[model samples]
Every structure is written in C-alpha cells, then in structure tokens.
Target: DTAVSQTPKYLVTQMGNDKSIKCEQNLGHDTMYWYKQDSKKFLKIMFSYNNKELIINETVPNRFSPKSPDKAHLNLHINSLELGDSAVYFCASSLFGENYGYTFGSGTRLTVV
Candidate 1:
C-alpha cells in the first residue's frame, strides 16, 4: 500500500485560478509537512503540522495555505494563484523526531499558465 499519496498528480491552471492538492498518509505518522520545489529545483518548506496543529509556517505567502483535518491528512490550498506559483508540491509524513525520516508523496505538479 502507498504510505503517502497525493491527488491530481498533474495540474494545469491559469493565473488567478484557485486549486487544491489533497494528501494522505497511512503510515500513522503524527507529523506532516508541505514542501514546494521551484523551477530551479530548490525545495522550500511551506508548512508543517503535528496532529492537526500548525507547527511551522515557513513564511509562506498568504495566498498559500495548509490544512490538516486529521493526523493522516494534510492538504494544500492555493488562492489567487500566480505564474510564480508553478512548481511541484510534495507532501511528507514522519514521526516527530529528527532521526525519523519522512515518507513523501509522488508530488503534484502545478503549472500556472
């Protein structure tokens, strides 16, 4: 079974369009995070959640948001998307510890035209 999975593996939208990516992890991990990979392939942390509580925001823009309905689900919602929002969004889950590595989803490719 897939440990972590995200919906809409590929997304193509126009500027100003709103979209959302759904993520779920069956690993029973309490901690989940959302990361964005830009065209330059630089990964940046967007948000982190621990058991439905927001833990880190990473200074992400107000247009982007992360919502965790439960320990196993963390979803990303983007509003008023811009051209600069085109990138790969990845969802990962891990135990709340440094030593425990994360299990990431395949990633959602968001292309804002």
Candidate 2:
C-alpha cells in the first residue's frame, strides 16, 4: 500500500493557468500537509490539516489553497500560475507531536511556461 500519493507527478503549463493536485494517504494519519520544494530543493510547508481543520503557514500566498476532504486526503489548488511557482509539490503526512517527521510523496513537478 502506498503511504502517501499525489497525482500528476509532472505538470507543464503556461502562465496564468489554474491547476489542482490531488493527494491521498493510506497510513491513517491524523494530519496531512502540502509542501513545496523549489528547484534548489528547499522544502517549505504551505498548509496543514488535522481532522479537517485547516492550518495555514503564514508565508504561503493567498493564491495557494489546500482542501482536505477527510483526514486521509488533502489537495492543493493554485491560481494564476507564475514562473515563480515552478517547483515540486510534495504531499506528506505525520502524526501530531514534536518527534513526527513527515512521509513525503515522490512529488509533483509544476512548471510554468
């Protein structure tokens, strides 16, 4: 069983287009997260959800939204894609607490032309 999965592992599009990436985890984790990994490989948390409650990272743009239909799934929606948005999107999940490190998906590469 896949612990975590995200669709469209590679997405190429022109600027100003909107797109959505889907994520699902079968680990029965209570919390799920969306993280962006830039070309330089710096990973940053964008959003997190636990039991359907949204937790926003202050640095994330308002143009990025996260939707969690259930504890097992969280999806990322991006509006008006920009070249700056070209990066790998990773989906992760972990239990709540200090010691929890996330289990990340391979990642979805979003390239804006």
Candidate 3:
C-alpha cells in the first residue's frame, strides 16, 4: 500500500464550483498535512493536523478548509474555487521527532477552467 494516497488525482472544474479532495496515510504517524504546489512548483503548507486536531495554519485563505477525521486521514475542501486556486495539492504524513520525514502523495492536480 502507498504510504500516502489521495483520491481524484485529476480534477477539472468550472471556476465557481466547490470541491473536495481526500487523503489517507498508513504511515502510523500522528501528523498529516495539506500542501499546495503552485505552477512554479513551490510547495506551501496550508494546514496540519495531529491526531484529528488542527495544529497549524499557514495563513491559508478561508476558502480553503482542512479536516482530519483521524490521524490517518486528512481531507481538503475548497469553496468558491477561482482560477488562482488551480494547482497541484499534496498530502503528506510524518512523525514528530528526530530523523522522521514526511512522505507525500502523488498529488492531485486541480484545474479551474
């Protein structure tokens, strides 16, 4: 099984549609995260959760919401999607300790047309 997996790897939608992407990881880590990769390939952290609780928010817009049902699962919801919101989103998981690093999903490419 994949360390981290995201559903709907490709999403093509109209500009105003609302959509959600789901992620799950079996890494047995306490923390999971949502990250957005811009066209320029810069990955920025949008949200982080530890054991179903929100732990970090990296100044992401209100249009973007993250939910963690459990430590193994993290989902992202996007509302009022805009052209600017088109990007690749990645889900990742990692433990909080020395030498443990995040393992990322293959990524979901969202395009608003």
Please list the Cα RMSD from the true structure of every candidate, rounded to 1 decimal place: 0.6, 0.9, 0.9
Query: How much does candidate 1 score in TM-score?
Result: 0.98
The estimated TM-scores of all candidates read: 0.98, 0.95, 0.96
What TM-score would you give candidate 2 relative to the actual structure?
Answer: 0.95
lDDT of 1 by residue, 1-113 (tens): 99999999999999999999999999989999999999888999999999999999998889998899999999999999999899999999999988999999999999999
Off by over 4 Å in 3: none
Using lDDT as the yardstick, the better of models 1 and 3 is 1
- In model 1, the clashing pairs are none
lDDT of 3 by residue, 11-106 (tens): 999988999999999879999989999999999999999889898899988999998888999999999999999999999999966598889999
Query: Which portions of model 1 show Cα errors greater than 4 Å?
Result: none
Top candidate by TM-score: 1
Report clashes for each candidate as comma-separated counts.
Answer: 0, 0, 0
Q: What lDDT would each prediction earn against the true structure?
A: 0.95, 0.91, 0.93
Q: After superposition, how far is residue 79 of candidate 3 from its true place, in Å?
A: 0.5
